[model samples]
Target: MDTGLVGDRRWQEKIFTGEWRDGGGGVLPVIEPATGAELGVAGKAAPDDVARSVARADEAQAAWAAAPFSERAGVLRRAAELWTEHSAEVRTWLVREAGSVRRKAMRELGGTVAECWEAAALPSHPLGEVLPSERATLSMTRRTPVGVVGVIAPFNLPLKLAFRSVAPALALGNAVVLKPDPRTPVSGGVALARVFEEAGLPPGVLHVLPGGADVGAALVVQPAVRAVSFTGSSRAGHAVAELCARHSTRVHLELGGNSALIVMPDADLDRAVAAASYGAFYHQGQGCIVVGRHLVHDSVYDTYAQMLAEKAAGLTVGNPAEQDVALGPLIDAHQRDSVDALVTGSVEAGAKPLTGGTYQGLFYRPTVLADTGPGAPAYDAEVFGPVASVTRFSTADEAVELASDSPYGLALSILTADVTAGLEMAAAIPTGLAHINDQTIADDAHAPFGGLGESGNASRFGGPAANIEAYTDTRWITVHSAIPSY
Candidate 1:
C-alpha cells in the first residue's frame, strides 16, 4: 500500500532530525479514527534513531539556549499566526485522524493556536519592578530557559496538549523534541512544522518526533533532555514519574483521574445536568479531568439523574464522519474493550445502568451507572470512556468527603449557586484545580495544570510565564567582584 511519493498536501513520514532519530528504524501505521482505517504511517525511531535525535538535540540546543529571548519568542508568534491561517485544514485532519467532532475540534485548534501566539508575547509582559540600592547596586532577579525539553501528548487532545507544551517551551528558548501519540500522529496537521520553520527558528531548535513508550522513555532518559511535559493515564504517568525520578529528571505530568463533580442542593438542576453530561461525554470521556464521579447533593439527585439520562440518550453515538454523529468511537479496540469490561464489571458488581452499556465497533454507549460499590472498577478505576458513576451526598462537607475519598486528585468541578459555598468547597477539595458554576473542565493557559496522589505529579501551567518557569532553572547572580562598597 504505497501511497506513492509523499506530497506537500499529504504526509507520509513523521520527521525526526534530533537525537530522537539517532537509532532509527522506520515507519508504522497511524490510523484514522473515523473508519479505523490507516491514514498514514509514522516513523518509529529505533534505538539508534533515538540516539541520533539526542545528539542532534544536544548539538542544536546550545545555540538555541544562547539566542536572545526576544528573538526566540518572535518565532512562536509567527507559528501561532500560521496555525490560525491553517485552521480549516488542521480541523479536517483532526476530525478524520483523531475522531474529534468538527465544531469542537475547530474551536480547540483555534484556541491552541491563539495560546501559542500569546506565549510568544509573554517576555515583554510585566512582572515586578524594584529600585536599585546604590551602595553595591542590588537589582531584582528574572528568569532563563532550560536547554531542551521532551514534549509529549496523548491521542485524545493531541494538538492542544502539544501546543500547551511546545509553544511555551519555544517561547522560553528551550529547544524542543515532540513525541506525539502513535495513534494520531498527524503532527498537528501538515503545516505544523512549516509554521515553525516560517516563524524563523534556527534549524533543529524545534523537532517533531512521534513514537510509542520505547521512544518516549529514550527521550525522557536522555541526558541532553532537561525536562518532560506529558499528559496521559495515571498509571502511565506514574511510570514516567518513576523513570525521571530515578535520574532526578524534571517533569510535568497530567495523569489519570476519576474526578468528582459536586453539584450542591442550591445548584440549578438544568445547569448541573448539562455540566455532568458534557463533562462525562466530551472526547468520549477520555479526558484526564472528565467528571467520572457525579456526586450530587441528595436534594437534587433524582432530577439530576433524569436530566442526565435524557441528555445521554440524545448524544448521537456513531462514526465521526457521519453527519449525525455526536459522540464517535473510542480510540481503538483496546479502549473499546476496556470500556465494555469496566461497564460489565460494574453491572456484575451491582451498579445499575440508567440508559446504556451498549458496545459496537469502537463505540461504547454513553453509559450511566449508579449505586456501584466505592471499590468497584467502575467507580475506582479511571474509566477512560463515556461512563458516569453517580453518588449522592447530603451536605457540602459530605460532598468534599466523598469526592476526596478516592486517592486520585487531578481536577474537580463544584457547581453551585452559592458563591460563598462554592469557594469554601473549592478550598476543601484537595485537588489541584476546582471549577465553580461550571460542569465541564476549564483550564486557563496561565494556571498550573497537573495532579497529586494517583493523579500524577509535575504542575504544568501552559503559557509564556509557566513556559519559562517550568523549563528554566533559576540561580541568583551574586556579583562577588564588586569592590566592597567600603
Candidate 2:
C-alpha cells in the first residue's frame, strides 16, 4: 500500500474511483497551519465532476443496496481495522495538515474507529415495526434508503466528523457524496477515499470531493441527492438548509454552539476548575460543544475565577510538530485574528482579563476573562478558541437565566454536590445535551448527537436509532390474501 505522504509517487493524483486519477478541477495546495509551508496538493472537484459523481452514485446505489446485509456490515467492520493499521501515517497528516497535537490526533483516530464499528451494526438492526391494519389485511412498515446522501464537513476534527455521517449512510445502503473543506483536504477527504477503497467498498458508492462553498452548493441542490448531512458554522448551516428546502430534500445539521458550564455554591471547587479548563481549552476550543460561558455562583465566583486563571497561565502553547504542548496554533491567521478580536473587544467593554488575552502568530495563549457581562463579544457568541469567560450569578434562577440567554443551545453542564438540584436546574435550560458534574465537550458513537434552536433543527446523528431515522424513510406495506366484495 502506498503511504500517500508528501513524497509518495501516488500522491500527485489522489482522487480515488478504485484507482487514482486527476480530479475534474485543477489542483489545490494543502498548507501546514503551524508553519507556513505547503505539505502537498489535492485534486479539486469541478461542477462537471459533481454531476458525474452523483450520476455514478445513483447507478451504484441500487446494486449496493441489494447486497446481503452481512456483506454490507463486513465493509464497515474492515474499515475500522484499516483505520487502526494506518494510524501512524494518518497521525502525520493530522498533525501537519490539520494542526492537531499528538494526543488530539490519537483521540480522533480512536473515535473514528468507534464510529465505523457502530455503523457496522446498523445493517443488522431491525428495520421497522408491525402495525395494526383495518379490516381483513395484515399491515407492516419497513425502512428504505433515501438514495444518494450529500455530506459537507468542516476542517476541525475532519476525519471523525466526516465519517460519522459517511459510515452510517453507507451502512444503511445509501450512496454518499462528501465535500470536505478545501484547506484540510488530505486528512478530511483524500485519506478517507483511500481507507474505504482498501476496505473493498464497491466503486461509486462513496465520492470524496475536496472543494469550497461552490462545490457544496452544487451538491445540496443536485436533483439526485435525496438527503444532505451538514456540520459547520450556524451561518453556513442556514444557507444549506434553505437550499435543501427549495429542493424538497431532507437535511441533518450539526451546527455552532455557545454552550454553558455552571458551577453551584456547594460544588467541589477543584473539580469545577478542572472541568472548565478542559472544556474551554481542549483542541484549542475549536469544537462546537466547547464551553463558551462560565456561570459561577456569586458565593464561589471570586475563588473559582482565580483558580481558573492560574491554570490557564500555566498551559503551554506552541507548534504541535515541535513540542509537547497543551494548546496548538489556530487553523490559520484568520481564525487567530477572530479569537483575538473577540477577547480584545470584551476587555475594552469592561471585562477584566485575568490571564492571557494576546497572541503571537497563529498561537494564541489560553485566556481567562473575568466579569464577562451580557453583550460582551466573548460572552454572547461562540468564541472558537482557548478563551473562558466567567460571569457571576446570585441565585439558581439567575444562573438559569444566564445560561439560557444565548441564541445557541447545543450543550449545557451543571456542577454541584447536590445532584438533584443540578438536574433540576439543568431541566430549565433548553439544550440538546445536558451534563451533570461533567464538562460540555463529550461524544459517544452510540448516542444521538446534535443541538437545538439556532444550533440545529433537532436533527441528530449516531446510534442505531438516529442513523435509521436520518438515512431511511418508513413506508407502509399491506398484504391481502384475496380481494373481497367492495
Candidate 3:
C-alpha cells in the first residue's frame, strides 16, 4: 500500500495538539527502501516545532496528572483497542516505510498492543510506599509525573521502540513530545499519534514531530521536557546523554548491541542452527539484540558452521511487501554499504566467508564467516547486519572471554544440552539479558528491557517498576496531627 495512494489525511501531516497540520520544515518524501520508490510524503518538522511541542505538552500535563486514574487507564485501554482494530493498516506502513518483512511487521503490531495494555495497568498500580520516620509522624512516598517527556525513536522497530516509552509516559500522567526519525516518520510517528488521537487523547498531550538531528537536539534541550527516552546508535546515544546531562534532564537510552550466541559441543545441532539463523537474519539483522557473534565449541564447530551456512544460502531475499521472503533490504544504501564494508574487511583479515560476502542493491544475503578472530570488523564491532561471524572456542572460559570482549553488554545466548552449564556460562557474562537454549533477539512487553555499558544508561524501560521509575519522580511526605519541635 503506497502511502501516496492512501486516503487517510493524517498520515501525510504532522500531529500536534490532537490535530494534523503541515510542518514548519516542509515535506519529507517517504521512500520504499526495497525498490527506492516514492511511497509518499510526510510533514517534516523544523527545530522551532520542537519548542512549540514541548511548551504545549508542559501546559497540558498538570490537568492530565490530576485526572482520575480510571480516566488515564481508559485512554491506554482504548489505544490498545485501536491498535488491534487497525492492525492491517499499521502492518502495511511498517512493511512499506520501515522495510520490515510481513511476519516481522505482524510481530511489531502485536507487541505495540501488548505495550499499550501493559501501560494501562500503570494507572492503578501502587505508586508509593509507607516509610519509617525518626520523628513522631507518618512518613510516606508517592510518585509524580515529570511534566513533558521527550521521545527520540529510531527507524528499525520504530513502532515498538517508540510506544514502549510513549504509552507508559502518557499512562503515568505526563505529556510527550515525540521525534521520529525522518527516514521512517509514518510508522514511528504518525501511526502512533493516530491511534492515541482516535482513542481520545486530549490536545497537547502527545505531539508527533517527524524530523532529523536538529529537531532531536531541540527536544532534548527544552526546559519543559524533564526526561528523554532515546533509542539509536551508541554514538548518537552518547550525544543525547551529554546534552541531557548538561540540562539536568533524566535520560533513558536503549542503544546498540553486539550480542553473542554461544553454541556448546553437547547442543542439539538442528535446534542450535535454527536459533542462530533466526537471530542473525531476523529483520535483516536490523535489531539491537540480534546475534553478532557465533562462539562455537571447537569439537562441533565444523558441523555447526556447515549447518548454518546451508540455512543462510536457502533463505529467499526479496521485497517484503510483495514477497514472502526470509530476508528484505537494509533501510537504505548507506546501511547496506556499511554492512558490506565490515564483511569485506573481515574477510580480508583472514576470516572465511562460508556462504555470503556480497550484495545486490539493499538486499544483503545472510552471511556466515568462519575463523573470525580479533581485529576483524564483523567479529569485533556491532555490524548491525545479517552477518554471523563464527569463532572457535576450546573451553567454557574462552567462550565467556570472547563474548565479553566487546564494549557492548546488551544480550547473550547459550545453546547447550546441559542447562546447568549454560546457566553458569550466562552468569559469568556481563550482559543485562541472557538466554539458555534460546536465541538473543528476545523481548517481552512486561519485562525490564535495557542493557549495560554502551548499550544504554542501565535505565530500563518496561514492566511496572521500571516504567514508573522512568516516567515519574518519587516524593517523600510526612503527616502530623500536632506541630513537632525542630
Candidate 4:
C-alpha cells in the first residue's frame, strides 16, 4: 500500500443501477491528513437525495422480496468472492481514505469481506421451528425480511461498516440505502456497488449516497425505510434515533464507547503491554470497542506501566501506506485536536503522562498516563486516538467497580493469571462483551458483537440468533381441520 491521493473522475459516470447524481451537488474533498494533500472528492447526499435512494430501495425491495432466498444468498457469496479478488486494491484504498496502516488495513479488509460471506450462508438456513399440537391442527414459525434498511457508515473502515447492514439485509431479501461517511466514501461505494453489479443484482436493490450530517439525516427519516443501522459517535447516534422515532422505524446503533480493561497483579506483564499497545494504537484507537481505559492491580502497576510506555514509544507513527508503520494519523486535524484536549484535561485534573503526550500532523504518540480518581475524564471519555490512561485498583472488587463505573458499556477485557479472579471480574463488569486473557478487539463473525446501554440504541448483539433476527422477522402460521367447521 502506498500513501497517495485516491479517486478518479470516473465516479461521476458511475451509478449503482438506478442511483442518481447527488442532488445537493455537495462535494467533500478527501485529503491525506498526514500531508494535507488532496486525495479526491466524493458527492454528498442531502435530505432529498436520501429520500430518492429510499424510494428506489423501496421499489427494489418489493421485487427482491420475491426472489428465492438461495438466489439472494448466491449473490452475496459472489460479492464476497469479488471482494477477495480486489482485497489488495481495497487495502490500498482504505489506507489512503480511512488512514489505516498497511498491515492493519489488510486485516480489516479480509475480515470484513469474510463477514459478508458468513452473512450470505444464513439464508440457506432461514430460521424455522415447529410446535407439536395435541388438540390443535398444527403450528409453525418462520422469518420474513423487513422493508428497506438505511445504513449510515462511519469514516474509519468505511466499507466494513457499510457491509454490516448490506450483507445481512440483502441475504434476507431487503434492499438498502447506504449513507457513507463524507471523508471516506469512494472505495466503499464504488467497490461494493461494482461487486453487486458483477453479482447481477437488479437496479435499486443497493443505493449509495455520500455526504455529511445532512445526508445522514435524510436517510434515517425516509418514510419507506423500515430500519436504520448506524455506526458512529454517541451524539450522532442520538440524532439518528430521534429521526427514526418520527417514522417509527427500527434503529440499530453501534455507537460511541469508552471501554475499560483490567489487568490483575498475576497477569503476564509483557502480554498485558502488547494488548494495551494494540488496543490503543490499532486504527489509532478510533474503533468503538477499543480498550481505552486500563486499570491495573496496584502491585504490578509500575512494572506494567513502564513496559507499556516503552512499547508505545517503539511504535512507528507515519503515513499509513508504509508497511512498517504501526500507527496512522487520526482521521483529520479536528479529531487530533479532540484527543489532545482530552489528554490535556486529564493532566490538569492531576494525571501523569508516563510516556507519549505529543502529536505530529494527525499522528498521536501512543500515550500512556497514570491518573487519579475514577471520576476523571480519561477514565470514562471516548478518547478516540492512540491514548490510554492507566490507574491502580487495590482489589478485584475495586477493579470491577472501576471498570463498570463508566456510562458507556461497549467492550472490556480482564487480564489475570488467577482463573477465579478473572472470571469474577468478567462476571462483574457492566460491558456488553468482556474478554478474558485477551484484548477486546477479537470477535468472531458467528458470535454476537455489540455494546450495552449507552453504547448502542436498543439493538442486540450479532450472532446466529442476532444475524438471522436482524435480516428477518418472526411470522406465525397456523392450521385447523375442517372437522371443527361442523
| Runs in model 3 lying further than 4 Å from the true structure | 1-6, 13-15
Tens-place lDDT digits, model 2, residues 1-486: 245433354645455544567778788898888898988778888777788889999999999999999999999999999888888888888888888888999999889999999999999999988898777888889999999999999999999999999999999999999999988887888878878887889999999888889899999999999999999999999999999999999999999999999999999999899989999998899999998899999999999999999999999998888898888889989998999999999998999999998888888899999999698999988899999999999999999999988889899999999999999998999999999999998888998898998899774787998999999999998888898787
Per-residue error for 382 in candidate 1, Å, reads 1.2
Using all chains and alpha carbons, the TM-scores for the candidates as numbered come to: 0.92, 0.97, 0.98, 0.94
Q: Report the CA-based lDDT of candidate 2 relative to the real structure.
A: 0.90
lDDT (0 to 1) per candidate: 0.75, 0.90, 0.90, 0.78
- Rank all candidate structures by their TM-score, best first, as comma-separated numbers: 3, 2, 4, 1
Q: Please give the TM-score that candidate 4 achieves against the real structure.
A: 0.94
Give one digit per residue, the lDDT tens place, for model 1 in 133-235. Answer: 5546555555566777887788887788788887777676677888778787664523355567667778777777667788888878988888988788777
For candidate 2, which ten residues in a row score worst on lDDT?
Answer: 1-10
lDDT for model 4, please. 0.78
Which candidate ranks first by lDDT, i.e. highest?
3
Q: Which residue segments of model 4 deviate by more than 4 Å?
A: 1-9, 13-22, 457-461, 483-486
**Runs in model 1 lying further than 4 Å from the true structure:** 1-11, 18-23, 125-142, 188-191, 480-486
Give RMSD to native, each candidate: 3.1, 1.5, 1.5, 2.5
Which runs of model 2 end up more than 4 angstroms from their true locations?
1-14
Ten-residue region with minimum lDDT total, candidate 1: 1-10
Give the per-residue lDDT digits (tens) of candidate 3, residues 201-291. 8888999999889999999999999999999999999999999999999999999999999999999999999999999999999999999
- In candidate 3, position 7 carries an lDDT of 40
Candidate 1, residue 114: the lDDT equals: 67
